[model samples]
Target chain A: MRRRRKGSVVTEILTWVVVVIAILWVLFPFYWTVITSFKKPADVFRLSSIPWLQFTPTLSNWQTEFTQRGPEILRGITNSIIIAVFASLIAVALGTLAGYGLARYKYVKWRNQSMAFWFLSQRFLPPAATVIPFFLLMKSLGLLDTRVALILVNTTFAMPFAVLIMKDMFRELPVELEEAALVDGCSRWEAFLRIALPLAAPALVATVIICFSFAWNEFLFALVLTYKKATPMTIIIAGTEHTQGVQFWYVSTRLLLAILPPTLLALTVQRYIVRGLTMGAVKG
Target chain B: MRRRLREKGNAFVIPAIFWVLTFTIFPLVYSFRVSLSKVLYGKLVGFAGASNYLRMFGDYRFWGTLRFTLVLVLISVCATTAIGLGLAIVFNRKMKGLRAFRSILTMPLFTAPVALGYLGVMMFYEENGPINVLLKYLGMGKVPWLSHPLWATLAICLVDIWQWTPFAFIILLAGLQSISDEIYEAAVIDTSSGWAVFRHITLPLLSPVLGTVIMLRMVDAFKAFDIPFSLTSGGPGTATRTLTFYIYTQGLRNFDLGYASAMAYFLLAITMIIGLLFFRRYRELYE
Candidate 1:
């Protein structure tokens, strides 16, 4: 009995050790980025140093990023916001209806299955493969370098994943409410809008956040589609370099700004992240 | 009544289908068209037939970069899966502060890969960086991380593992948490050793999720671009350029749209094959 208890105690200690390591490994880079953003430019590249300590904190990087590179950075941020929000809205709006259709209705044999596969498989389509065609198509439409082009392309990529997620969301919801609403002389559309939509609100929020993050972080499409007019935050962050050197401080500021929205949204919707990420394959 | 219901369902679905199809299906055909021709300055200049593909197959850099990408995918996917599973298993046990611990652990998935790439630059810096600093404290010499070929690959892999392990962990943890306590209780009684119970029961039950997670990671790893693109820029003389980066440079930089489209199609084929395999396994799991 004593040996067994000792064994468990060892296991317990080991478990906590592993957990601590995982947490530190995950958070350290983010913490480092945050601190590096606050440090002065000289302090950033100081030889043989620790982050978050032994360095004078200054807002100079932020000041410079805002003042010197302000227009471009702000433009990137604005573009990112506009694109992510519109793309997410478009994806969510279209995806919810498709999801409901897939969830509640039976189509011809294998039809639903094939449609779901088509939707889910969009995630597998290499953006590299699709970018050239999108570029040419957008150019033909005379929409290159416009936010609308980004919005449309982002929607295309985001909608399929959004559909699958909302499908799963709708699948989990019981049909009794909608049935009763229909029985009470409500049309199917009205029942859907009044009853099902309200219940699926949380899942909708999760879908929106996921779509928003995907659009915001998308790089290659943004890179190829928009040269100047709609260059999003990711491009701006990637383009942050000076002739002198790495410009660690300025880059850190850009990194911090770029990651803030997705990080906050992911944390708030932590419960739904696995669901959204896996396209609702494994429910969180 | 069924006909009306079907009509309604089609109504609800057709609009989205049209939207996604325009992007995916049209691009696929357009890409294939471009792949079969010579695209010069964004125009189809001549009929290349299989020449673009023939050229790609013959190019030594294409084969070399592909081999490099496959190697990186194998290393990173395996590392991420192993680490993710290990962390999940450890955290699966009931413990103090588990919720808070998990919340912190998942932040990396939220951060963009490009951001992580930049962060990797700072963290993996040869001089005055944290990793080297810690190594120096341990009486070890600094290793050239991103400057050398093999070291650059390893550096990129480390960053990939750091960013993606949480994604795997989250999926596996959800898988783990879904297992009933009763199953473990029964297994514990049947086997005197913990390892025996795990090897026989826990692993078998978890294999499905593990397989799915591995396939997902593999697909993403195969198409890895942002990390190498931002971190090394496929640096040290094309040593770190993966297939996607290669394609990007060919299409975007070199203006060889036809050749780039062919390469991208080749990549798409690889991704599709994996996706099909995954779909088969996923169908088995579900149906």
Candidate 2:
């Protein structure tokens, strides 16, 4: 019994050790970015890992980014917010309706299963395959480098997640409520809008968050489709490279700015993150 | 009333269907047309026949980058999944601070890949980055992380693994938690060895989740762009240029629109094949 007890204790210690290592591995890059964003240009080149020990942290980089680069940074942030919000709103609105339809109604021609699968398959169509075409398409419509163009493209990509997740959500919801509402002289639209939609609120929130994050973090489409006015935070962060071979201090500040929104959003909806990311596959 | 309601129900899906057809299917068809025609300055000048597709046969860069991308996908997917599974197993047991640990662990999943890549630029800096500094303290030589081809590839892979392992961990952990405790209790009665219980009971149960995770990771990894774009710029003489990166350069940078469109279709075909194969094998998971 003593021997078994000792073995269990050793295993517990080992597990904690692994946990600590995993935490450091996950966090160290973030720590490095945060500290580097605070470091002066000279201090940034230093091999110092600890803040206030190896180098003095400063607000100078943030100051410069805000003052001299203020307009550019603000433009990127505003564009990112506007594009992500509008795109996600459209995606969710459309996806919820489609998802509810697929869940509740049976289509003879397409079939619900095939329709759901088609939407899911759209999620797998790589940005690479579509980017060139999107660029050309946007250009021809005179919408290249416009927020509207990005909103449209982002909606296309984000809709798949909304459809798939909401489909699953509605399917899991009991049909009895809607059936009862229909029997009570309620119109089908009324039954859905008043009954099913309200009950699927949690799933709606999850889908919105996921869609928003996907649009916010989107890169390739933004890279290909937008140039100046519609440039999102991602492109701005990447654009740092072209300006005199990548000023790390400036880039670090921008990097933090770019990630802050999505990070906070993800944490707030932490419970739904696995399901969101997996398109409701794991049901976390 | 029933027929009218059914028509309205179908109408719910129309808006979404219209959006997809306009934005996705239309672009794909347009891209296919562009691929077949010769282009000058983004305008289709003439029919190129099969020239663009045939050009790939002789393009060493296309073949080389495709090979490199496959290697990256294989390594990144395997490593991320393995480490994630290991961590999931370790954290499967109840403990103090597990929630906090999990929250911190999943932080990378939400961060932008481009930001992470730029962070990687500093983290893997050859001279004075934290990693090299640590190596120096450990009495080891500094790795030319971004300068050398091999090291650059390794750096990109490490960054990918760092960003994605949490994704695998969370999903697999959920998978682990879903297995009822009574099964493990039953197995424990048969064998006191934890390894025996895990190998026999946990492994089989977790296989379905594992399969899903692997398929998702493979598809995502196959389209990797942001990291290589920011980190290496496909540098060290295009040593780490992925197929997607290569296609980007061909179409956007070089204005080889015809060839880029062709290559994009090629990539699309491969991606669809992989998706279809996984769907065929794992149809039940989706249903």
Candidate 3:
């Protein structure tokens, strides 16, 4: 008993040590970024980490970004918001219908399982493979360097994720409820919208959050698809280098801008994130 | 009634099917054709029958980048999974402030990889970056993080691990949670040593989740571009250039569409093979 008690105490202390380390590892970069954004150009090269104590905090970088480079920054933010929002909305809408179809009905030519797998497989295709083709397709359609081009690309990529999550969610839901609604003299579409869709509200919200976050943070597509007018915040952040070198001060501020929306969205739907990320593989 | 329902359901899938046919299937087929044809400045000049594919075999840069990519994927995936699993195991027990801890830890998952790469530039800066600064405070020498080839690769992997470890942790933690307390209790009763119980109970039960998290991380790591692009710029003489980065440069920057298309198809082939193998193993494990 005494030996076991001693061992447990040791394990408890070790566990807390690991926990503290994990927390610091995760938060330190974010902390550094936030603090760095507040520092002046010279102070950025200083060894000061603590705000005000090690060095006086200034908003020169943020001010310069807003006043001097405001239009460019605003354009990126607007494009990112428009693209992410539309892409997620379209993906979730189409995915929910297809998900319900796969869950409710049987197809003879291509089995539901195969169709669902087809959607999942699309997610595995390296974006590199399709990027050239997508660029060509967009260019041919006169959609290059446009927000519409990005929205179309982002929607296609995010749709598979939405389809997979909603498919699993719809499959797990009890079918009897929809069946009972059908027997109550409701049309199939009516039963779906009134009963099935409402019942899957939590999953719908989760899918939307995940899809939106994915589209918001997408970089490669934005980098290739847009030039000036439709540039997303991601492209703006990555292009923070000047002739001298990378302007770390400006990059820090821009990163905070690009990171804010998706981070907030993820926090709001924290519970469903694991499920959405894993495609409902593990029920978080 | 059944026939009517089937038709309605099939109609519901039309929009999704149409979108896929236009965006995915059409693009893939076009890419294949582009891979087979010679293109100059994004315009098809002539037919190049497997010459682009044949050129890759002679290209030393292609071989070097391929080797570096495989190494990066292997090391980063393994390191992320190990650290994530370690953290999950340690935090699996009931503890105060666990939810807050989890929320904070997983924040990286939602942030843009490109943004994180930019953050990495500051965090890993040699002269006065936080990491080197801390090492200096501890009376240690500052390592040249971005200048040296090997160290640059390590820096990229470190950033990748930092961003992705949370993903592996959450999934594995959920996997851990799903394993009932009864099994652990039963195992503890049979063995006095904690290691024995963990080995006998926890690992076996967690294998399926482990397999899944590894596969997901592998695929993501294989397509690594943003971090390398923003962090190192594939610097120290292309030491950190990924295959995707190579494809991006060839296709977009150099306008070598045919060669880039061929490389892209090569990447797709590799990804598909890995995915198929994983699925086969997954089916066997479940069935």
Candidate 4:
């Protein structure tokens, strides 16, 4: 009894140690960003390593972010929201129908399997490879630095993801409900619109969040495809380093602002993220 | 009803398929054609007929970047998977405050890589950064986390690991949770040691998820550009330039579209090969 108790006590200490270290490793950078954001510009560059509340906190960084750089940051936010929203909406709409088709109906002449693999394969194509073509195409169309260019590219980018998630979601739902709806004098379109769409609402939410999150985070295309007009938060953050060195105060403030909305949105849908990310490969 | 449904389904799918074809499929063909032609001053001057491919194959910088890319991918993928799996195992049990910890743990994954790069600069700053301060307090010399060549590569990989490890954790945790509790109970009844329980049962059951996670991280890390672009700008020198960054310089900066296209296509081939191999394995495991 004495040995068992001793072993259990030792294991308990080990578990707590690991948990604390893991949490600190994951969170300290974010914590530091917040504190550094509140630091005065001079204090931000000081050699005094203020660990937390040891130094005087200033609101100058927030002041600059809101006042001087306000329009640029707000423009970035607006561009990101518009692109992400349109991209997710279009991707979801097209992907839902195609995903439903792929999940439910059989195809002819190497149709279903080929189409599915083709869509999946594009997800593997790196963004860098497609940038040149996109740049030239957008330039020729006089669409460079336009939100429309990003919206269109982001739609295709999000489509494969949406399709994969929706396909899995549709596949898991039993066909009986839809079949019953079909038997009750409903057309296939009506059955799908009224029955399958409502049944897949949870996955739809997951898909929407995933699509929006990805479109928001996308950088390379946004970088290559736009210049001054459609500069997203990502580009603005990347360009924050000035003729001097990095102003940690300014950068941290912008970084915090840039990440907050997506983080909050993601947290609300945390459960679905695991499933949506793995593309239903592992059940959450 | 069945005939009409099939027709409607075809109609439903055609538009989506067409959109993908226009954006993805057509660009691929166009890129291939551009790869075979020489571009001077942003204009395709003439068809070079494999000269660009030949030049890329002979370029030492391309080879160096290729080597760096492989090393980066190996280190980042291995580190992320190992650390993530460790955290997943630790968090697998019921514990107080686990939910909040898990949520906070995922914060890095959601943050933009650009933001993370700026944050990395502060975290590793030489004079007053938290990491260096801790090092000094511990009686150690400050390491140049981003200035030196080796350390720059290491810094980039560390940042990648920091951002992506949470992703691996979520996937692995889901995998762990899917295992039936009866398996562990049976092993306990057999008086299995902790290591034996993990080695004999947990390892095999987790292999598929582990493989998938590594493959996903490898493919993603193989194409890493943003962190290095924002953090080190591919270096104090070219110490941290991966294949993607190299391609960006050649294509955008130099305007050598033909050569850059060749390199891009080569990268596409390599990534596609890895992607297809793992995809085949993934299909086998699931289908």
Candidate 5:
């Protein structure tokens, strides 16, 4: 181990202390939401002392949610899931093929640059700029409050990231492996589907998970496109706007269920997120 | 054979192309057309051309929201990046319980924005709120959290910081892992102090990731709505109304589709320029 000066040691300690506090500040709300969710509406605010856990937690609020808003929330969840699944599938599938083409095939002059620019534009655009337009178009198409609209937007939003990442992954795979396969009886499609897709599975998995999170957590577009029929999980959370003013416990229970998808998704894919982000950076 | 391969490649790309065209390209074009037209009872009417843009420029609420949005983005980006970088450096240490710390740290990033919005409203409510409660605990009196304009800014900032710093942490932590052990080893052998190592090595190495994070966070901050929209509804009298809220209010609530589309176009222009700059400069990092 290396030696450090006294001042450096103090700086390090202070840094950690600040970070620990910030982390607590960051996480406390989510913890609070979950804690408040499982409690009876009346007991929700009363159990401030046991903020971390509830010993005699009642299922009344959860039951209320199940009885009244359960189907509504489920519909939203199903919409979110279907949209996310389709979006992720389309995005990753197209992205992999696009990536392979860019990585392996030579294009005419300015073709690469144009394609590169197009990909970059898609990747870098903030959803805010594009969402307003989507609302109007969806209304015109009579696609408002539908999973199709959500799926379309989600895939477009995710495609750039998918392409960028998958390309990097494909580029790094040894050309010799593909060449070796070509030397055998394999055509390009066979080489890609069999050789490249299998090799890129980890990256593909990472891309799908990341895309799902974005789609699942999206709010602004969902609010615009869907009213109540096809509301997403994010919209459901946003639906608690009046609950804050109207009924505190009802709001709390609603808030709890709203965040379940993201919480479950993030925790499950926690390991993959860290690795996918890192590897894609260096490889790209 | 090349033609066949090209056909196959286009076939593979069909799904993505169709999706983008329908959702993104079509929406953008429709927004442009809608911005130029007047809305008549849920139907688009005759084209108004630059008249809508002119009206948007004249609208005080639009400018007010746009100004607040600019300030919000600038301040939040600076605040979050400075603090997030410091925390990332600390977490990079060989600390005890780092894994648990990491998982704990990311919980904020995982929380629903809508839920977190209410948490802010609750925290800063004038009476019986934790913020006030904590103030009393610290021997300080309660501060007006939502009543004052500055206080409203503070409320939004606190929520923004609370929600997004975890994202910064995750991105930066991932960046930190990519730095080779040998580089630090070499710096240590050179008798470089921690400051020197950080200033000379880590800063430059992490700039790419930092740039990406800043761009993303700024774009996000500019588009901030759900928290402020849900929490304050752009109040204490339009204090927290962001450009996005303005667009939604105009387009949806007031049903003034023309003005809203114009405002949305302004937003699009600003973000487009910023995004272009971000990618152009930082993209070299990948190369």
Candidate 6:
């Protein structure tokens, strides 16, 4: 049975090796980006070099990137934050009410259909399709370069998703609370504010995180819609002159800058990441 | 009471519908009309009447870009789904540090796509990018990255795989976790081979989730624009030009609105057909 033991041992070793390789392959780009960002152009592209552990790290890239390009990047970051946060708040506010109305009332034929329609329509077009009309509409409003433009556009896209999740949460809440609240002097709005909204807190938290991230990470709209005033960090990074070669200590540091706030916010609310995960897991 | 409810419903949705009507649906129809019009003095002049559609028929760039997009989408979708499924299974087993590992794996999904695109260029460009450096360190020769069509596509695809495979993993793992423990115990008692049990039980049961994830990723990959747009800009003689990229080129960048509209409409039509097919198949899964 020595050969049998050998075979199983080999199998186990092979599995571990495969897993390690796969994980490396998955992380190659990010790891490579992080590593290269610390290296000078010469070391970054050398014909003979080790990966990661040994290198003459440089702060030159970061110094140039943030010191010279700081304000531009900051504007974009601010725009992204403003757009993502405010838009999601607006979306959550409207969606929460709509969700409860549908969940509680139930008989309206239009409610389910409209919600589904909005959900599908909100996401169906790659921002590519809408970019044109969205641009035109933004131009008409003279809101093109303002963070307000992003807020409006992002809210349009975010509302349906926010509504879908909130509806699901509301559906799970027993109807008696709402009925009792309504029976009291509380208007439907008061009942909604006083009762349902609190109950749906978890879903709302998830909705806000998800929507905010979509706005924050959004590339196309920011690229096209806001050339100057509302440009996000994503667009600034996309600029060819700003992003080049391996002398990128500054880029990744700046990248870390833009990434950190959202990352911290995300980690802080990571409890809701389950809602984020499960949202896409089950259909609304 | 119900009437009050109806009024409440109207109150919440009216603002949202107004936003969509003003921005989204309105512009969609308006753009269609303009697509049918001819540009005269930087303004729409005449109704083209399928001329825009006909123009796309002969546009080699549009077709070439479309073919490239299909290849990118097909490969990325299959690759992400296969790798994601494998990872999900591995992590599904009782394991050490799975939670922490999962959080790490998902970090890329949170990185903005535009930053990821720039990250790709810095990491893959021939002279200073680290891939070639590592290659040479291992005694391999350096290869040009951005200057060539094939490597550019590969680079973009790698970035997507890094950024998005977590999405597939999350969905599939959720599916796997939802399967009850009893089913596995039954299979174990039957003395069934693990592979057979997986093929017969796990695979079939996971089909709905698997199907949805695949369809979602495929559509997502198909419509992918930012990575290819930012990294390659459909460069190296239009080798990496995707259909969506072509739309941006023709419409926004080049100001060829008529042709771009036709291309956009065609993309919408294709995605709708595929999306509807998946939506119908999985309707039961949701309801």
- TM-score on alpha carbons, each prediction: 0.96, 0.96, 0.96, 0.95, 0.89, 0.90
**Which one is best on DockQ?**
3
The predicted structure with the larger TM-score, 2 or 5, is 2
What value does the lDDT take at residue B29 in candidate 1? 97
**Runs with alpha carbons beyond 4 Å of true place in candidate 4:** A1-9, A47-52, B1-7, B284-287
Using Cα atoms, each model's DockQ against the true complex is 0.57, 0.56, 0.58, 0.52, 0.38, 0.37
Worst 10 residues of 3 chain A by lDDT: A1-10
User: Where does model 1 exceed 4 Å of error?
Assistant: A1-6, A47-53, A242-244, B1-5, B284-287
lDDT of 6 at B225: 85
* lDDT-superior candidate, 4 or 6: 4
A31-92 in candidate 3: lDDT tens per residue?
Answer: 98899889888888977889989988997888998998999899999999999999999999
Q: How many backbone clashes does candidate 3 have?
A: 0
Q: For model 4, how does the per-residue alpha-carbon lDDT over A36-127 read when each residue is reduced to its tens digit?
A: 88887777766444555567878878997899989999999999999999999999999999888888887775467677777777767887
Per-candidate alpha-carbon RMSD to the true structure: 2.2, 2.4, 2.4, 2.6, 3.4, 3.8
Which prediction has more favorable lDDT, 1 or 5?
A: 1
Docking class of 5: acceptable
**C-alpha local distance difference test of each model:** 0.85, 0.86, 0.86, 0.82, 0.73, 0.71
Q: Provide the lDDT at A227 for model 3.
A: 84
Q: Which stretches of candidate 6 lie over 4 Å from their true place?
A: A1-28, A35-53, A56-58, A107-111, A183-185, A240-247, A267-284, B1-8, B137-139, B284-287
Instruction: Order the numbered candidates by DockQ, best leading.
Output: 3, 1, 2, 4, 5, 6
TM-score of candidate 2 to 2 decimals: 0.96
Chain B structural similarity (TM-score) per candidate:
0.96, 0.95, 0.94, 0.94, 0.93, 0.92
What DockQ does model 5 achieve?
A: 0.38
Per-residue CA lDDT of model 5 for A35-61, tens digit only, reads: 666656555444453643534566677
Candidate 5 chain A least-lDDT 10 residues? A275-284
